[model samples]
Target: MRVTSLLVATGVLLCSAPAAVAGPAVRIHDVQGTTRVSPLVGQRVTGVPGVVTGVRGFGSARGFWFQDPEPDGDPRTSEGLFVFTGEQTPAVAVGDVVAVDGTVTEHYPTAPEETPETTANQSVTQLVDATWQVTGRGAVPAEVVGPDSVPEEHAPLDGNIDKRELEPQRFALDHYESREGMLLRVDDARVVGPTDAYRALWVTSKPGQHANSRGGTTYTGYADPNSGRLKVESLADGPFPAADVGDLLRGSTEGPLDYTSYGGYVLEATRLGEHQPGGLQPESSRPQGEDELAIATYNVENLAPGDDPAKLDRLAEGVVEHLASPDVVALEEVQDNSGPVDDGVVAADETLGELTDAIAAAGGPRYLWRQIDPQDGADGGQPGGNIRVAFLYNPARVSFVDRPGGDATTPVHPVERLGGVGLSASPGRIDPGNEAWRDSRKPLVGEFLFRGRTVLVVANHFGSKGGDQPLHGRFQPPERGSEVQREQQAQAVRAFVDEALAIDERARVVVLGDLNDHGFSPAVQRLTAGGALVPLADSLPPLERYSYVYEGNAQQLDHVLATPSLRADYDVVHVNAEFADQVSDHDPQVARFTVR
Candidate 1:
């Protein structure tokens, strides 16, 4: 009793000192507990035993992950831990048995500028202000993560999932939380998302589920985030493959399960699998017929004159060959002459002139463009690069009805002329003064004549889903705060479309661009609320509906809608989103409509 009391007293004294001596051992599983957040968070845990699994010696987040060689029987509690060594290169090697003493912490990843303060991300359980000493050496035995090991259910049906007890045998997110910091393996993983600049690639453990024809998982709805999708990053900093969708990571890819702002629950692989090419190719759409009006929408991903010549060439190539030279193109993210430089320039004439010139140079038609310059720094996008939407029309196929009196704040109203509906000001802004356009790109409404039939086009670059909580956030049904602004933006566009329809029942109005929200979302629902327009993408084959790829799930963000009069036929050109070498993150969409 006396010896135990003296040792305990000595340990308390050492806890305050810089140095720590091993005293009274605790299990790593106990420190992890069974909840999404560590129960022992903010409490000092002494002598937690683990074998060093991996180390991240670079960047602001320098840390080492270790796992207990002998894991506890309960699958609910994790047997591994991460010791955050802020900015210091940790001197530790894999396979070393060590005893750690530190405060158990629940670390949440967030960027306050984008993500709202109310929303919460899944907290990573870690050991901070830690002191550790090597006790011995051991080999890291990784547990296999596959269809059998990973459950079908992604998370519980409904509720705040953070406080819920982990059910590794059932929920996929729970399974990942249960194995946090633990070494895991995936055999013959199928690539769903291409390898990004950060050397991270996404793969699916369970294949043939929610599978798209292009060897990727389609994120069709919010109900299922695709439980099979797993993110992998190489820890060795060695030569890793830049894989595309439908490729294969051939054998035994082993790593420690980690959580970060770099997409939740990543597998930092110490051993990367052999890269196997899947030979996936891009799909091209056939050109529109002589009578059909092909109007395509492409988000040229913040294109500026100063960008890489190859990128501009690739975009031009996609426009000319892949998209089959549409009569009218709605281009988004067209930055000013000085791309991303914070010099207060808002004009994008040089940018568009270069692109139109590029298309002409690429054996395409001589397309002319028209757009209004947005207020400097008022639109939300890359700082200083005032990104806005513009229209590019091939003068040979269609003629612009230049009504010329539109500015950033001037609203364009539909006026009746010659038994047809015409805009009060062609190439006008839609209700720009409304609060809906706050820090958002205002919709550009333009009037064009295709073979004597007038067509009204609304080029929109709505509020982005930038600040929404991630799908795997701490809160179930993660908060989509960005939707509120987008919904309002949708209503404003709908109101403008309604006005045109009210003036003339058959307005020939085409509301198209990067709507930023899914077709089933509330923002999109508001767009088609009164049956004023119908989404052309909805008419596509189930597997072929996607225009964007996010986290291995091929989804839709760009949309094309028209009044009931002009039923449109749409094709999502799969040139960029599926490939590792992409000109833009979004794929160009070509919608063909026949005018009376």
Candidate 2:
């Protein structure tokens, strides 16, 4: 928006701002106005008064944030502005008062890596194409964020988030919008989200917002995404601590709040709080009783044979120590022998063999695995990974019904054998041709014998939430586009379960895996439709239910469901999701049932 004169580009008039507006002295609050979007957007302003509060000297988004030292006293309008210099580092330092010349712009940002359609993030109001003159230095004021300021309600305009009036006193999102680019503080913050590879973590300004047992904020529903939850990333040099959930960032974490595509509203902190260990430990589910069969579901994040042997060893220990070596484990994201190398080798025997071998090495039961190799490039994941779902069962505890002729394309159906329910092909795919399973992992159904009773297990890895808009994206409530395919997938799996239970009304069928949707989501609802299966996640305490954490929100993406006929003792083993040095992104869930 640097055009000084009217210019035509591709037969379209491209202009920065009205020259009349450029001459007038407009304050930063006047530019930001009282809305999620700036009212003065696309208009050029001269002498927009503010003091440099924060300077982002690195990255592709180099800029300096300035705030008005004098307050407007309006709760809705923000008194701060971001002078986006693009890749050029800003010349001004913090506390230097400046008068700027720039065009007000609404920057629609995106997450650094949006799993879904690279959706547009909620617009971050910025002053672009700018030049500034240094005035006298001024004090930078930082407002404290707490329950007294931010509201319990998150977004006022749920789906239609942008261009709306900022109700700073009513909604938390609006309150954040009101403080855009301004210095803010979270005091004595509790680390709710574990520290990631990128020196960033999530903390809570308002504690007790569905605070999980282990300090992290629990996302109970779509309505309340925990407005207190704020992502914290340090602007100061030195390494960010490997902070886990339940850890404490004791004391003040002060910084200018900036919105990005990564997490919705981020506090690019100039001062991080003291790191205090919370002593949060990975949990282990109680071992199965002598007559009980324990089943677990874990997504070993894209594990391949060529991956570090330590990774396999870690996963093996998670199976043994964290999940108590369940009798049967349904594993997701098991890659082929050569991980991520596009040579078209689809067999995962070596990959699965290494995992089972590692389990034995870790002093776990001698586990045998069963799986049907999916056709190359058919099931979608990492391009060359060909990740698929497979089962690992302890031979000493349970027996796999190895009916032959199961392949990638052949669908497994329920059959009656010896007056009990069994699968047509023990290790067969379910409805691989369905449109629901297109570019997704097909369901793998297996029949098993536990204490002389027939048991059927259906393992599924649904289409990811990769195509859905983030919660903090432009759209309110966010668009779950991937849910369409996942819902269809749930239906396909539900139909399979229905057929199995139909064959035997009192049959023991366990449906589990990385369903990749919350228990409250439509996909999960459809999977448990008609009461064909009961979701075990729903039965757990809300604070203890989550199996995955993303962007500071502790949520569930993996589940164990069972038919009503089987009594279940279930626990979600908390291992990877809350820890920094995790082998997998997901924590495995184990369910036990007495068969004899």
**Looking at candidate 2, what is the lDDT of residue 94?**
86
Model 2 residue 398 lDDT score:
92
On lDDT, the candidate that comes out on top is 1
- The lDDT values for all models are 0.86, 0.85
Off by over 4 Å in 2: 1-22, 111-118
Each model's total of backbone clashes: 0, 7
Q: How does each model score on TM-score?
A: 0.93, 0.94
Residue-wise lDDT of candidate 1 within 236-334, one digit each (tens)?
968989899999999999979998776788999999889999999888889999999999999999999888888888888999999999999999999
lDDT of 2 by residue, 505-594 (tens): 888989999998999899999978778898887777888789899988899999999988888899988989998888889989999986
Q: Ten-residue segment with the worst summed lDDT in candidate 1?
A: 1-10
lDDT of 2: 0.85
